[model samples]
Target: MAPEARIKILLKNGATALCAGLVALSSFSLGAEAARRHYRGHHHHIPQVPAAPPRALPYPQLPLPFEISGAQYLPLAWTDVKGWSDDNHLAAYKTFRASCKSINGQTGASEPKALGGSLSEPCRVAKTLELSDDAKAKTFFEDNFAPLRISRLGEPDGFVTGYYEPVLEGSRTQTDVFNVPVYRRPSNLFVRGYKQDSVSLPNKGPVYRKIGRRKLVPYYDRGEIEDGKIAGRGLEIAWLKDPTDLLFAQIQGSARIKFDDGGVVRLNYDAYNGYPYTAVGRVLIERGIVPKEEMSMQRIREWMAQNPDGAKELRRQNRSYIFFREVNLSDKDEAVGAQGIPLTAGRSIAVDKALHVYGTPFFIEGELPIDSERSKTPFHRLMIAQDTGSAIIGPARADLYFGAGQEAGRVSGRLRHPMHFVMLVPKGLDPSVRAAKLPVPDPRPSEKIAKLFPQTDPAKAGTPAAAAAPGKNETVATAGPVPLPVPRPAIEPAREPRRPVKNRSHRQQ
Candidate 1:
């Protein structure tokens, strides 16, 4: 379990996986071709059947260059209210999910003009709704969806999910891969959700919230599972071997949009997540990637035809889907000064660039008063920002993704306290915004960690920390006064590059 050994192993596995994927790609031809199927997870008793097998989701997949260990998450507020089941209503949900997909250009031309609304001008049409993937998704929407505008066919109930290549991606390269930014337009249904407190917008800007069951059970992929911990539930996910771009669309809400432009107005959710898919499609269309009337689906194919690399990303985006119930983490404890990994669960805050960007190495020196259901308690120490959630949106505000079960639920429900904390940003970033700088008197003459642990030579400590230990996040390699490992690229060669080979001892000859 030494750090160097771990790093070497991680290096070996990663290199091997990359080589395998590259080899697979070279051998098998990849494309838009696919068969669609009705998936009923392992628990479903139904026979497996394919209605239309998806060649793949429409967005392309461009893998991130390096592994993202942990970044603090701002969380949203949501919980499954009362009774909800997907088994009974899947057929109905399929219809709605299908309708939204079809209407939003999942498979056809996105009808920007449909339903009388546009991002520039609040469309007067009924807001769209998306049923969940489960059988009941459709039925639930039918019962709960409330639309302001009547559907062209009849009446609409608000419940539409817009699927777009998160603008950060549709527009740039290093995309917010998991983020679905554009749920751009919110109809009256959304207004209702916001107003009734069915949904809560975090006071802080755009950080994410942890989606959890009422009990804050953490969601973990099998590989990340620890023996005694319970894993969380969410959309099943997988990484496509090849990068690809797929279908994208926008499903609007009922709130009437008021554009800052003012000439025409429609309610699109303030680009909270990002622009709606419909909005992005319009922008892309205006740019002439495809005709205004061309189905965005096929156009995506055409776009891929023209931009081969992009084609992969488009497909990748479409194939993936997620469902979340953001929770509040108010009751947990905070550890300061000690080297530790943070849980995506528990209360958290986001800072602006002036303060600290996500992923700052954190150190809390003073007491962080806990809002206990019982009595006051102070817990603080060193913890790395591991994840960011949806509710944490603003530069100052943040969602507290509550970690697990009834206990976490009860504690998180009431958590809110101010604590003195400090952070270490990627060097050169202004630190005033994070927390007042921590003081370290100049490396006093001969003051080194070697003085603390004489047997653990500083020279031996210089070896790369092993990255092979996949389950543990990072080994806190400290050289004494430096409690946390400075994120030195030089120190992490496994994640970066190998050092130069040492020359043989010529004197030995």
Candidate 2:
């Protein structure tokens, strides 16, 4: 009878035990045959039995809610977000719409590699909706996106600092009082590892200067530039009163240069000196020059003013320098961000571009010292990732952009705090569905292959018998204990004979 027919017959007759016994006998026979061949020295090649394929899982393995480098994401409901309902969604929606313009422009090959095409559907839906009502705007976000608590992988909370457009009095041309020059990008400056004469500078990379036809060196640092290294190169766009104002403007990345004749020139970040940013405020704290609680832009300015030489020394410690380019904007317009659009004060935030998309929305909840230096006002709002800064790194780090002037600076300067971060991921990238489809991992081979290999008992690991067992590289004699040599006693026969002879001579005398 055929194997199938026999199997059916056994099942019909209820001979399941006999069938299992036959399978066991067959496995034992195969194993015995291989051992016999080895003992007989037949030298016949024993064919390797391929391992059995892993059994299929009844359910798929679950996956994390989202994937962001250096970050972990936990799925959350909209209700879980603190103060979500009270936030001004309309304002956030407007900023989101502005970023969507840039997002929509990136299609086909121009899509961002990090986020890919995940955000396109949401951007399309946003463009079709004319959301005037705040309730409708909130509904749109709820329907199209999912909220996830995002933070740095090992960190428990997110951190935020603040920046603003510094308005400093200046002149278009260098004058006696307004002598410190605010420089434009130098002609010789280029990104390192690229052609020196390239038409445009890349958005990201270390920048360098072409010394000659074949040599490239780091671009002039803040100290070198301040000391007039590139003075006669006609790189000055405007002139500020002191180096202190210029340094602050560089830290902010943009400034409104107001002339004595009432003309205002807008200068935005063009390039940088390719050195790592060192926060002067942090240095002050480290050196015990400024207390951590009193470390703010206003305080730093006061300290700098009191000690001019120390200020210059502190400024030189931050070697990274920023170059500016003129932007055509009216006096009423807010300062533009790295996204090439005018920023929304209190709504726009600069996030780590390496880890997040520009158009992403984040809901931040925390108490901040906004009202006063020591006041803790609740700061719960929806913020848009519309810009980036060198200092703003990591998945959960952000820099909040306030508007221009002294009041804006005061509020922004005192805003370094920890907060809760909830990222709004679009519905297109459904993490739950993706997680459900993930396959379970294969089982370990320890149980299946255990009998074929020699096993060692954990309880006898350090015993003499276990230690005496030869390893792959050891011989039996080498692995066993070695006998120690015994020392011999010293002889004293010659001294005893000499003492006996002396006693005999004394007796004869």
Candidate 3:
């Protein structure tokens, strides 16, 4: 037979086998249900049988949220979102289209694990439609997806912070004014528990440095690096004005370097040391140096300026250090995010990548201190998940990206508040279906097991005789099954007796 004919035959056989297996699975489920019914009919006198739970709906209904994988999702109508009708959907749609460039590149088998290939159909439809008006763009999302109120299992609302691109004055070489160096990723750095030259490193894990051939050790921390460790290694990317500029840039993950010769250098996060990140602002609040209500990035900067020695000590409290790599971007362009796309100011957000996909749309509604530190204004808008950060963890935590410059930095630094998170999930991946598929817990123990473990006699239950403690010479009767002993209340231990002190002063005199 020809090779093409053999290949076709193999494909046909595989399809047939898949169909057969599905049919068998359906039959097995039906048989199990029938057996359950027959048992219930014959054993109607079994008092230990539990009542049936309410059946799950085929589609999500109102008022009851479904839970999956430690997150709760409450399906809602589009009108339920607070200011959905008034927001500019066109801007969000444009950002979504940009993210689709990355999403569409993925094959179905390699699609994001959180989305489970459900976004493929939505991306295809979005590409085919050329929407011009905000109304049409809004309709497109409404037609293709369902909005779900998402939160962590125990949290009441999602948290939102803001980040911005820090533009700082710097120099290419170490000068008198710009002496603090920004280092690039070291050649010896590697992911922990992996070979030195691993082609693919996992998204989440500790990183380490390799010495010689086989010995692996932790990378240099912030203090060691600040003390001039690993210097003269040809890893300097640029030199900033002071340590404060470099620290803030590291916290924000990216920065633009402005030089005196009318030149610009863009740097993006490349790697980090294995140590965990400790926020210095939180440390200040814990030590009562800064009040929690008045804490902000600007405040930290001002404090650092006034107390340089204390600032150095504060910086060393956070041991994690960041490395950067130069990117080729014009001054007019925005910074590229972890999603490999230019982030749209006010429209892009960094989410917990482990719990959410990059291209997912979220409708946020809240009041924020946008105008002043104490003033609150309504903030309702749609945002796209285009980035991820080390601090952005949990199902409901996010970081909103603001644009560049000092004003943007000021606004972003003051943005930290709780907000409502409504995720627009594709209809193909139904939350109702996922909830229904969860295995029902086993019913109460059967009558035979209950009989084997009989309950205490009600007549003797909680009586004085049953509750009384036995004396040392008492002989307790064990005529019938022994009842469980009643627990005694906890008693405080006896205190030590006071002793008289000697008159050491009189003896010295």
Candidate 4:
């Protein structure tokens, strides 16, 4: 054959082989792409890759006048919630449902204390269920809500105090025996801007009284009120025997008045004098009179009895004063709290209404130093935010209600333990809405993101790009950069174990 013809035939065969290989490679790529799309569309039956443990995120701190300062939180998984499975959620469910009437009915401007519009769906879901057993209630709560562990600044624990409804011996009219006067909301007392003030604390709104023609001034303190300031106003509700009992009763916010004739009446918190609350127990601790670990209301009362001469001055140390309104206790044995609902014995808790809404569920774990055998025992349960107090200041702080009478008082007065708090917000409502209220800067910015998207302005690099990274947990917002979702780890397929071959040649060998 000719040399030119042979070279042309070799070139033609090589070209054909190259074209066949390219067609096969393109077909294989297309097949792989189709399989991936199919897998994404139908993934329900397939087992999901186990999620990595949730990383702690920086929660925003309150910045407004109404917000509790320095209070923050972090998102935690259900497994992170201690004693979650052990709690009797049915008891909590009962307490929560009691506040639903008030919560669901609530309208107008959203108040800080009660469940407003956000709780409507959860409340409705609760109303439909029978919730007869503990298991069902537990499941309901777990399915409906996610837990957020609350902290102050960065610390996970805070002080847990206790308060209770007191039962006092009193008379409607002032007598020789019953001389101490329990005053009503004075007629002369006025609030700033409004003709009458309805808010219970100074922080909620400014409280004032009309002194001159049009001038408004802060209402009188405990000292002035005890003197002659509210003297001839005909505002006295009832008179009690002991002055110390009246003082403690004011701090507790409610009292059941028992008469010699065996009849009883209730007095609930109506108004305050706008003065900041000073805990006398705290006063004793600061003065070095009583050690903080040993200080309790029972001990304070005993100290006051021992030194009657200085009792008057010590009682006056707390400038905050409480006024009461006569409430009928015919319907229920327990006193109605600030939420206008009957407070449960161990289930109710008093928090700063300015910080938390009423009917909100809080899971607390702490040890209470009550007088009974159960004192200094671990208490892990779900409690409802039923009331508010002057001294309940922070987001982590709470005053647990120990029911009524002397036993309740004994338990309540002695409790001064550190507690862990986990707030349960309603499901479906974006918790980021609350977090967005006060945008917190990321404490530890992403070093990887910062280096990748290096900022021209050195100052802005940590503040912007590093914060916007997904796993780094930046504050959620509409305007800021949307974080790219973290890619999940690829899962390998399962393989069958190989069976070893049997050795049958030993006898023949």
**In each prediction, how many residue pairs overlap at the backbone (N, C-alpha, C within less than 3 A)?**
137, 0, 0, 4
lDDT of 1 by residue, 251-346 (tens): 211111112343212111121222112233444566676666452433444566688655544333322211222122222222110011223323
Alpha-carbon RMSD, each predicted model: 34.7, 20.1, 24.0, 24.9
Shift of residue 435 alpha carbon in model 1, Å: 17
* lDDT of candidates 1 onward, in order: 0.30, 0.83, 0.84, 0.79
lDDT of 2 by residue, 69-95 (tens): 788778788889999999999999998
In candidate 3, clashing pairs total: 0
TM-score of 1: 0.20
| lDDT by residue (tens digit), candidate 3, 33-141 | 9998899899765578787988976544443223335676687888889999989999999999989989899753754355666777888999998888999999988
TM-score of each: 0.20, 0.73, 0.72, 0.70
Displacement of the residue 439 alpha carbon in candidate 2, Å: 1.0
Q: Using TM-score as the measure, which candidate wins?
A: 2
Rank ordering of all candidates by TM-score, starting from the highest: 2, 3, 4, 1
| lDDT tens digits, residue span 318-364, model 4 | 88888888887736678898888899989999887767778888899
**C-alpha positional error of residue 294 in candidate 1 after TM-score superposition, expressed in Å:** 57
Candidate 3: C-alpha lDDT: 0.84
Q: Between prediction 1 and prediction 3, which has the larger TM-score?
A: 3
Clashing pairs in 3: none
| Pairs of residues clashing in candidate 4 | 113-357, 113-358, 114-358, 190-208
